[model samples]
Target: MKRLALTTASLALAAGMAFAAEHETTVRMGTEGAYPPYNFLNDSGEVDGFEIELGNELCARAELTCEWVTNEWDSIIPNLVSGNYDTIIAGMSITDERDEVIDFTQNYIPPASSAFVGTSEDADLTGGVVAAQTATIQAGYVAESGAALIEYATPEETVAAVRNGEADAVFADKDYLVPIVDASGGELMFVGEDVQLGGGVGMGLRESDTELKASFDAAITSMKEDGTLNEMILKWFGEDAATYE
Candidate 1:
């Protein structure tokens, strides 16, 4: 009877271990895979970008397995609220308006000033016709400043508009627009000083998921301390673009 009881206890312990091993918290992350150098598809059609690398690091630090879901840029928040994803890791800026609907982790990436680029070498539309993605901070700037706002669905569209002379200049985050400018082979040039966009990139979590948000904030802090964050930034944007401060 003693041997039988011991065998039963061992089986129970083994079953508990199996259950624990099989149970892993999965986090569904959303991103618009069109933002190059942030979260875009590569030539091979795989998601290979800065935000993707950073997301992997955050998942590792939090001890969670992440499933990335690509969505349209405009629908990222609506889909998040509709239960399409648990968190948003796209290069999303944290703003007062967004805060009303979702909670954000501490700024993992600081916001760089926005810049305007034009096709003409002497394109002096510093305060003239401005093109930015609709509903974005850049658009807000154009609206407030009374610039002719040419709205586009994506950054690529805005860039294309400038290249095709459909718009005078393209206004967007420097990190996103710089690569496009370089790739345009001198077709685009910076028109003016960078415009301040008072926000930073952060992980967007549902308001009710405070526990998950806290975990993500802690993981991001730990990664920043250990230099893992810097390394990934460098890998994506080169050494000069790794500033987190």
Candidate 2:
């Protein structure tokens, strides 16, 4: 009888320890470490970007310790669902299709979409055109019109296709592609007015982590209120680009 009682006490103590560890509030964050100005490896080979800074700010606001892990963009969602990470701070857009699989925090940035086209005089993709990258929302826009589509694996590849006159245009997030455009030496232009994608970049987590989601949402809200978010935005994208509502 005494042995059984001791066993029971031991089990209870183990359970308590597990609970404490679970609620210890350490956030394991994931990022692509490829998307620049959002999350990427800097010249010093260190992980540094807008999302990285924002993650630190959010952690501070929530009083949580954060550890960042770099992962490929395509695998980020799957790995998060498999418990490889606690949250994804990658510059992931909050789309309804993605929401069906994982939960996302409230948007922390304004949505900005644009199209890039080659500078060649013969290349013209204007007024309702197709885009490279079929899985993207831009592909959906192209499919709506039954237009011929151009597809590629990465934004850089898509932009290269446009520059090479293989593709008419590449639709992508303005913030992600704007730097590439400037570096292309007038080889690309962001045509037409910006398209509001109706979703902003946010952190992603497993659907079962409701408490963590709530905590992250609250932290983001606090950062916004305290001007920490705006400050970080300015630091990365300059003052003009920092003017986000």
Q: Per-residue CA lDDT of candidate 1, range 1-245, in tens?
A: 64664454345434433433465557888988888888998898777788888888777655677888898888788899888998888888889998999989888787667888997756545456778887688888787876788888888888888878888888888888877778878777887677778578899988987666766776676666667787887777776673664
Clashes of 2: 0
The sequence of per-residue lDDT tens digits that candidate 2 reaches over residues 122-168 is 44555433456545666666656455677665556777776666676
TM-score of each prediction: 0.86, 0.80
Model 2 residue 77 CA deviation (Å) reads: 1.5
Highest-TM-score candidate: 1
Error of 2 at 223 (Å): 1.0
The alpha-carbon lDDT assigned to residue 33 of candidate 1 equals 89
| Model 2, TM vs. native | 0.80
After superposing candidate 2, which stretches have Cα over 4 Å from the reference? 1-22, 120-122, 126-134, 242-245
